[model samples]
Each structure stands twice: as C-alpha cells, then as structure tokens.
Target: MNHYRQIAPRSKEAGGQLFAQFEGDDTIIVEATPPKWCDRRNRYNFHPSRWLQQQEIRKRYSCGLHFVGDWHTHPEAAPQPSQEDYRNMQDCFNKSIHDLNRFIMIIVGYAEAPEGLHVTLIGQNSVQLMFCENNL
Candidate 1:
C-alpha cells in the first residue's frame, strides 16, 4: 500500500504532458517522459527503456516504500495498457523481487476524445480493469 502511494504520482504524469493521478496512502511516485522524438519521421516514439529506467529510478529512490503500481498515456484518450504493456508488466514483475506485492498498469488512450484514462491491475497471471474514480 505504501509503495502504491509513492508510485501514484509517477503514473499521473507518466505520459509526457498528460497527467496521471493516484489516490491511496499518501505517497505517489511517477516515471514520465516527454513525447518521443523521431529523427526520420519527425514524430514521436514510445521508448520502453526510458520508461523502465524511470521506474527503476523511482524504486531506487523509494527503497522502503511499497511498489504499488504504474501507468502510461495515449495522446488522445485517457489511458490503457496494450499487449506490449502487459508484457512490460510481466517483465517488470519477473525481474523484481516484489512479486508478492500487487502491481497496477494504467494506459491512457485516445479512442473517442481527450482526457480519457483507463487503469488496470495485474497479479500473478490475472488482470483486472480498475476505475480511477473508484480508487479501489
């Protein structure tokens, strides 16, 4: 629970300029990046390594804190994790020793409109969709 609090802030701001907000405990940690830049296309790229580094930095900084959860954003919608997102979650869990703790994955999508964010929690081998408004 404590770790969750610490990691919430990072989730809130995980997507470049977009905002990620988490409620629970009192600590929130966020690992975010500006929109990626593409040299050839002159566009943006989602760099997974950068995000992972952010998480590692957060974990390192909050040594005693609990590893609550994490999230990312989509340009247009709220947030939702993709298949790659799930793989990243699994990779994070597999590489860490905090498997016993609950981990969350959030994806900000842009399906219909802006300001749309979706959150999900993954444990063991199961995944559950979560509502940020509910905060449960």
Candidate 2:
C-alpha cells in the first residue's frame, strides 16, 4: 500500500489484479500484480492486456492461484468508489475467466506513508465491505 505513493504525485489512481487460491471453500488471497497504469488517469481500468498478463501469472503459479479480482489506490482519505468501479466489477463478474462466484476489490486510499485499505466482496446480488489500516 505504501508503494502507491510513488505515483500519488499525479493524483491518478494505480491499479492491478488480485491473485488467490482456495482451500476447501475458503479463498486465500496470496498475490497481486501491479502493471503499468494505462493512458487514462483518475480512474483504474483493468484493460485486456492486464487480464492477459494475469492469465500468465495464474499459469506461473500452475493454476493453483488465479485472478480473483482487482485493487486500486484512490486519492482520498476515505475512498468512495466511482460509477467506474461498479461498471468494472459488474463487467468482471460477467466475464472473469476464473471459477469465481464473487470478486474482491481492494481500494487503497491516499494518505501519509501508510494508507487505509478497503476490501469489498461483490457477488451477483450481494456486496460485503471490509476495511483495514495499512500499517506498512
């Protein structure tokens, strides 16, 4: 989370893919791949290239881990997801290649060194929001 500050000077958001594995029915998030932010600023878009790269990451882990969702840094003390977030999640839910029924989004807020991290689990008709302080 602290690394997000490297790009905070622009006020543009940074984003990437969330990689995870499962044990029984419990999902264990284990990795995140941070790619270069595309041309668009102020918003995070997991473009097709990002998704394709995630596929390689999944393969690198021998399919044990897969793309589960996404994460991004917001320029706020308390990040309020824009309509773009909703559209992204909905699009992911519909077409994500993984065998996931729910997707997780980690929204990191811009603050001092360590920021606040918000995690939202999104299903077809359900949404669960969780939060944690970025001590790092």
Candidate 3:
C-alpha cells in the first residue's frame, strides 16, 4: 500500500497489522496500526512490537475492527514470504483469540510496480496466494 511504500525506499522494513471488519463473507480492511516500537529492523528482517498493543486497539474499537492480518515491505521485485514469515503466520494462527480461521499476509515489493501488492491467505489447513480485484 502507499503507506508502506512511503517508508520502503529507506534502509529498513516497515510493517504493522492490517485492521478490517467482516461484511457477510467479505473482510474489508479499513485501518492499520503503524509500527510503533519495533524490536528489530533491517532490510531483510523485521520484528514488530508484540501483540500486546493489539489488545488495546481491539478494545478501543469495541472489538469492531479485527486484526485481519499483517503487512510488510520486501525489498525486491516480487514479494515472497520468508521461512520466518511462514513461522510468524503460524504463530498468529495458533494464538489468535478472535477465533480466526484464516489470516492474511500482504507483502509489498520495493520496486516500482503496476501492482506492488501481493496478498496471501494463511488458513489452518492451507497457505495460498489470493487473486485480488482492483476495487481500491
């Protein structure tokens, strides 16, 4: 997303949780909590502040906006999840208290691209890249 891109050109990765709400069967992302206090930062790695703050956000919104997924910048032409990325997603799925069956991962490539965004659906039983429609 443009928010990620604005910080991608620099020397480190930028990331945060994606906030959204469900409408019937659809999940519509409406907001995000930018990285506040990242514990680690580098071109290839990022470890954001743990999920503690996420709880505050959920309460602030009265649990209306859920932590649907995460978004980060990748310094490459194509965004691909690293082994660590997969691990993180798995951790998220296991400890999720919202009873989420699926979590999303949005990777934004560094290169200028017509479509720099790549989204993946990481469910309890499957990990798959999802087709996106440009309704944005």
Top lDDT: which candidate number? 3
Which candidate would rank higher by lDDT, 2 or 3?
3
Residue 65's lDDT within candidate 1 is 44
Mark the 10 consecutive residues where model 3 has the least summed lDDT. Answer: 127-136
| Candidate 2 wrongly placed segments (more than 4 Å) | 6-9, 37-39, 42-51, 57-63, 112-115, 132-136
Clashes of 1: 27
Q: Candidate 1's residue-wise lDDT over 1-136, tens digit each?
A: 1121113323322333112234564335444333334211111224445555556546654654445555555443344456877877767666756534446665555343233556666676777776643343
**Where does model 3 exceed 4 Å of error?**
6-10, 60-63, 132-136
TM-score per candidate, in order?
0.50, 0.74, 0.81
lDDT of candidate model 3 versus the reference? 0.73
lDDT of 3 at 69: 85
Model 2 Cα shift for residue 59 (angstroms)? 2.8
Taking the tens digit of each residue's C-alpha lDDT, what string does model 3 give over 7-126? 345657778788888899888999766666644777777788776556645674696787778888777766667878877887787777776778989887765554567788887767
TM-score winner between 2 and 3, please give it. 3
For residue 22, model 2's alpha carbon misses the true position, in angstroms, by 1.1
Query: Which whole-number lDDT from 0 to 100 does residue 12 have in model 3?
Result: 72
- Model 3 residue 43 CA deviation (Å) reads 1.4
lDDT of each: 0.47, 0.67, 0.73
